[model samples]
Target: MKDTLKYMGVVVVFLLSLASCTKKWEDHFGSTSAQKTLYELISENSDFSTFTDLLNKSGYAESLKASKNYTLIIPTNEAMAAAKADYDFTDTAVVKSFVGYHIINSIYNVNTGVDTVKALNMRNKYVEFTHGEFDGVVPTQSNLIASNGIYHVVGQPLKPLQNIFNLLKSKFFSTKQVEAIASFDTVHLDGETITYHTSPIWISEVRRNMTTESRKYTYFVVDDESYEAEYAKLKPYYTTAYEEGNTTRPDSTTTFFTKKAVLRDFMVEGDLSPETLAAGVVSITGTAFQLDPADIISRTKTSNGAVYRVKHLTYKLSDQIKQIKVLGIDPRGYKQNDKRGNIFFRDKRDMNGALYQDIEIYDHKVTSFYAKYRALSMTVGKYKVYGRAIMGLAGDPQTAVFTQYVHFFDPSIVAVNEPDLYKRPVFNYLGNADTRMAFEVQPLNPNEVYLGEVTQDVYGNMQLLVMCNGTGPIILEYLRFVPIIQ
Candidate 1:
């Protein structure tokens, strides 16, 4: 009996040890067991019930229940109630957008420094995270981890700011004031062909390439009537910009110029105030216009931005479109190719800090030499013509005798009466003021030489000609046409 009892005791002790080992093994490995999901966590808190309902109505509840990682930047119920006026909770679309604004696709941590972290939200808009805060609101509570993802709580709801591009495209595109011109380029990346749309002019230039959420812009959206007014005012100057093979849209150039005229001067850098706008704003392009309080149609608030739809906006034509300056270095074609002269494009700066790019034409080896340049956007008005002709990067400026011709309407310059073709068409001496007008470029070259004043009869381009009777080289700089506002 004693021996049997000893064996029993050994077996019982062995069984106890085995049970303890099994318990420890289960505890270590079972750490992978499931816990509460992000939705469940939000559901547990009464303060987050508004967001919970939004997630459920948005159909995002099902997704958040899964094992995928997510980051929820949710606002409290009190916060939602305050912003309730801005949204219609009954609309499922609105609910979806609301929930999407709060959720991020990946796990995002709070920023530690002054630098901002632009986390893309579920709705494809950027959530600006700056110094542990997002959407200009610091989180009431944050870094709360759940089984599926992480979440942060804020006192205010987050709304993604519509960038200038988005605002311009979504709100005012129908006004026909701005066109999202699309151009595609195919690029090979690692033997794979990829294509993407190029940046439109509004985004690249007017917005100044500030595509980030950190930068704020106040876009003045012009009303349709005002847009047409500006277009009408600017159309006469852009008549000569011909678009070939576009017979269907004969006014394409005019329309494009007008659209640019409206948008280029409308965008201001910051969220300007009504008072400040009323006082007036100036564009970098030197366009100045003041807003009358009565002309403001409405002010619509955007995400950290706003769109002011206004009317009765007008600017001086000279201020709207700066004086036209054509560099002589770029010539369209020779007067006669068979009698072509040797030409060189040279660059230099004048004593007056003006650019004097030269279209040096010499060694023509012919009786007459003519180089033509097409000057577009010349309106039917008086112009003060200015010119500079000097040897660029050559030996010190020497005597250069050349006469210029400003031919309107017809660039062909068909000879009408003269028996000699070169002298007749090239000079255009048939009652044109600037035609056959001679100037000299001597060693004592002035920074700017007043060629003369000329009036444009037609609202279009002026075919400018640089002519020499084959006596000297054509050393010219630039031709500036300043409008003499009546």
Candidate 2:
């Protein structure tokens, strides 16, 4: 019994020593890098699995594995789902090609490479590819990492060679103005046909605040018959020639101009030059230019057109200002009242940080001087201003004019307490001027922020400004408000 106990003690000591040695070895070696094989990564992670399945079907799975160095852009299931809605995911060849393009043939782990390509709408310009559940992935979402490379789950595979032009055409076909220049085979240097599509872009390039980069577009002329058809639609609305001597509508019957000169410089030429379109009333910016009257009714097509970007919504003044009855307010708590009497008689106080002083405003009085007001067309809203009036209630009445404008402002200021009182108003007292403001109202998106301002003189001349502040564009219907006068 003694001998057996002594033997047991020795065995126990030996075992303890062995365990210590094992611990020491591990400490020196640190931890073995996770031996996550590529197969396991694909099989285990749903994102990778989806991608693998796609690759397999596309016959690109083996190729992906064979490549030693590659950047794999894996879209998340959510992204894939979105893509599927718009495109066909079942096509394996398409999937493989897209994956191939995304996979740069360089063996780069998460740490080895910088995020070269960017996702569609990521707040950050780029995302890194190394380490994380979804790093180094294309769509910036769920997928897994493995020894071989990264795996990402894409909702829809991308087209390998999609260009920016085609992408834009697909995204904005409804608003694009595309004309086949070939049809206008009889092209001349003179003012022959005013392609409505070309007119807005050309005019806007000169007058509107658009970057030169946006102006770089190839304008293909449309056939004569097509030009005539489009012209017939809006020509009637255009006020005929008011240029110096050769006034009245240029014989619409003529196709080519007898003389050749620049349209902008043509105004300087002899009275023989005719102004086929209205004088002085040019589009304010690209937004207000009504090149396509049909766009107001419906959104059609998805490909091809001229592209012009503008800061404010552009449409003619006739189209921008629409007349709308004051609809009951939304219970959500934004104020849209124009009670002038209360504003004039109430104690001067600040409501939501805006000065709310009751000041008497008179119409057409000596105080109300006729300023040479210019009405730039608005693209989305129906708005009208009687005449641009400066708030001359204090020293340098024009201070408020520069500080405050009657046009649209960012929508973020809408919910914020009123920053300035009566900042945007529609001047209504200008007489014999077109009083009827008309335009389509853009439906307010729940996510989009929109704010509009209109100011009125005591005589009731008013001006309005509206803008989109939130997620989407703001559409303005007819917004006309009469000042609540005593």
Candidate 2 wrong stretches, greater than 4 Å: 1-40, 44-47, 76-83, 97-145, 151-162, 168-176, 181-486
Tens-place lDDT per residue, model 1, 83-142, is 799889899888888888899888887886798677878777777788778867899888
RMSD of each: 14.9, 20.6
TM-score of 2: 0.27
Local accuracy by lDDT, each model: 0.67, 0.32
> Candidate 2: minimum summed lDDT over ten consecutive residues — where?
258-267
Summarize candidate 2's per-residue lDDT along 1-486 as a digit string, tens digits: 999999999999999999999996556345331134444445466755655666567665565555253345665555556666555666765665545554544434334344332222111112224333222234443333444555444445543432224433454344312222211223333556432222333334331221122222211122334334444433332222233222132222122111110111111111111131223223322112322322222222111112222111123323323333321111112223332322222232222344332222222122111111112222122333222111323331222212112242322235544423223433323422221222222222112112232432111122333221221122211223322211
Task: Highest TM-score: give the candidate number.
Answer: 1
Per-model TM values vs. the true structure: 0.62, 0.27
Which candidate ranks first by lDDT, i.e. highest? 1
lDDT, candidate 1, at 465: 68
